[model samples]
Target: MCGADRLVKVAFSGLAPLVIEDVVVEGDLIRVRARTPEVAAACPTCGNVSSRVHGFGLRTVADLPVDERRVVVVVRVRRLVCPTRGCRQTFREQVPDVLERYQRRTGRLARVVGSVVRELAGRPGVRVLSALTICLSFNTALRCLLRLPLPPLVVPRVLGVDDFALRRRHRYATVLIDAMTRRRVDVIPSRSADAVEAWLRAHAGVEVVCRDGSGAYAEAVRRALPGAVQVADRWHIWHNLAKAAGKDVAAHSACWAKHGPPLNDGPLARTTRERWHQVHRLLDQGVGLLECARRLNLGLNTVKRYARVAEPERLVRAPKYRPTLVDPYRDHLRRRRAENPATPIPHLFEEIKTLGYSGSFNLLARYITQGRVEADRLAISPRAVARLLLTKPETLTDTQRTRFDELSTACPEMIDLTNMIRGFADLLHPRPENADRLTEWITSAREADLPHLHAFTRGLDFDRAAITAALTLPHHNGGTEGVNTKTKRIMRQMHGRAGFPLLRHRILLD
Candidate 1:
């Protein structure tokens, strides 16, 4: 072959075994005319070599882009007659490596499209491919994505399992991961015990399964692989404890509320207190919750909430003030006002504006009119206090530490709750002695007067073995939880247009 011909063959090496005839650029498309090599070809069915050509047929196929332009290849293939005695069948020779059977695109181009669709499914994929000069429709891109094969399932010894919401409250799916490698294993369609149990029964090599506090999962693991060690996730345990501590903090809101400024008498607070009185008055007069809701023109849930609260003070929340330009100069304003209570608003605004305040003069006037400047103390909510109690001491700032200490010493119950939270947090660090520590922690929790902690202790008692394993073993479902988070992002990218099969395909392959 000449130098130009050799270069052509070398440049388009993907079309190996095909003789290049001509290459031309027509408009925006690069069209290549080629022919299959005139060699002996094997019959696909009977596995016999055929040399005699029956005829020649032309096939046009799309290929990868060349110089930001679409490439179309027109190749002349031979139709040979099989030489086998029993099968003298006429068959078309195929270049399997170059193109797939009955497909209009080359294998390499199809693989490129598959990769594009795999990451950006449907409309986004189409838009991206279109931008790259490759023509693709939305449904076509999805079809390409769906055609991609899933990875082979290999059962890992240490498995991590977690569930993510498919539609949130209506539907959910479970994701399994190899804890050691952090690679996703499989995604089950449902988060049911039966679904998990069936999976475990199919793949039997799992020795340690780490999961959350889902009873269905625990039950499934117990039934399917009784010999497997179950490790409860420490994050889930801490989350449950935070929830319980939040309830405990809320129940004793009076203890902390007294330490702060007087209760809010704003319009919202007044409305809440009035509604609570109205709901209770109706309930005391032999009226149903639904009747109270209808008579008061409120939703049933609203009426139920009011009836559930024993005191209206629990319903009143602290004022949540949004940050403003005046916040930076609050200390200056407070100090100036304290020195001279009769300070003029105009004078104060001018002073702060010179001190780098960028707020409008009217905004300063309104802040003073609202009495926020005089009201130096801000009311802390039970949820905020609960967060302080749950947060690690090392992570807390000096201000947060002071607030946490103040809330901790508000009542004897608060003191006990703080100790219990600390004890439970210590058990989260896995050690040989954590099992004993867990036992003592549960005993102390049950002995406390906090009803929320009592319920939390009951959950620990029910899942004792798994909880013990979590406190002792190092296995965790952190990787599985991360997979679930990625699954959520994938679902969001698909925009809920695709079904479980496509979702599973992306979760496993992507």
Candidate 2:
């Protein structure tokens, strides 16, 4: 092959069906002249063969870059006449693989744009496409994506549904997913039950719906897919229990004050105690939490916590420098133990209680059992006790365990709550005998007279069917949660151009 022919073969080799006739190179632009390789054409309208051409024209089209330079394919297209009777109109021949009619870019170029839009939404996609030297406006890129046909819909047997905030607490949208495949099925505009019901009505065959504890979704499922099994999400159930337990801890604020260390005179401790006292004093005078917070220059939550408790001691924590209850009596206890190595703990406690040992016998027992007392033991608060009960036992440290055991013995209420939390956690990871354990836990909580746990158990009883299915069956809303995360990312990446259709397209297509 000659030098020019070799250049044509090298540059346009990948682009077949359009024979390269001429090649030109300008600064930052590569222009190629090409024509159809076919000698005869079939008339599209009449389905008859035609060799006689009415005219020939040059059509310029953009294509994929060659050697990092922009490529423009100029093709010589022919307009052929239809020979069949009554079909006299002339029609242009089309190179199906190379170009599509009315599209300025090649079919390959459209495919590239489509892929880019699928990966990155409008503005980001435009920037990426521009860097590749195939320039297009943001609007054009989005329009190209919108024109692409949607994937074929397969009705899902197991559907997962969840709601994501469109504008966070203001506007929200619902995302539905195929639970087994973990692929997004559709996105509705709002989280209303009617919207979800309409979607369920449209696509039948949904045997199972895995969703969070949203009343709207529950109602929608009951109305639309009445026969489908609903499985309450494990994460949401745990979350609700946690929130209720937190409220329970907050309600018994007086207990915290009576049990925690006395207020200190240090700057931080003094300020905290003073704020607590001031907020309580104001609230005693019938001041609201918001007004109290504004007056004290503190957060509303802080003010609420302070006002909830009967005294400022509840707000006070053990000071870092201040000696613990064990600290003051440590030397005495040690001296007595050294004097009598075989002394009984009851005799030791009797000796301390007479000498102003206001600390619990449980605390003294732990100190004797551990053989040493650390300063961190003084820092344990009722909130800390609640946290320990809420957390898993395996993750607790030696100090936390000692403190927890002491606190549980001191407060029988805490022991009951701790058992409830642990039993609920066990139910979360259910086994064959979980049903018996659950019934026992429920009966115990009701009889314990703990309002928080009783209310939580009552709520669980209300949703017992769905909650049981969630624990026993292998289905959960984890897939729906994952889809919600993906949907959020798509919306955030879209930036200012977050229209519902574009968000839906990116989610479902990806």
Using lDDT as the measure, the top candidate is 1
Clashing pairs in 2: none
lDDT of 2 by residue, 1-510 (tens): 699677667767656888787778888889988897667777776778877789988888988887778999899999887777788678788888586778888888889999998889688899998888878888888888877787777879998899999898899999888888887788898999999999999999999998888889989999998999998999988988887676555444444433443324468867877787788788889988899889888898777667655555444443223344666677677788788878898888888888898888888886666445322234344455578768888898998787667655545656676777888888888565666777888898888736667768888888887787787777888988988877778777853554788777777788
List runs of model 1 lying over 4 Å from the truth.
1-7, 252-259, 264-379, 495-498
Tell me the whole-model lDDT of each prediction, alpha carbons only: 0.86, 0.77
> Clashing residue pairs, candidate 1?
none
Identify the runs in model 2 with alpha carbons over 4 angstroms from their true place.
1-10, 39-52, 83-88, 250-260, 263-387, 397-410, 430-437, 495-498
Candidate number achieving the greatest TM-score relative to the actual structure: 1
- Error in Å for residue 206 of model 1: 2.8
Per-residue lDDT of 1-510 in model 1, one digit per residue for the tens?
A: 699787776668899868888999898999999999888989988998988999999999998887788999999999999988778579899988685678888988899889998888888888989988899788878888888888889999999989998888899999999999998899998999999999999998999999999999999999999999999999999899999899788867767766554546788878888999999999999999999999999999888768766677667654444556887788788899999999999999999989999889988887777566766455567788899998999999999998888889888889999999999999999998999989989888888878778888999888999999999999999998888878878887864466888899898997
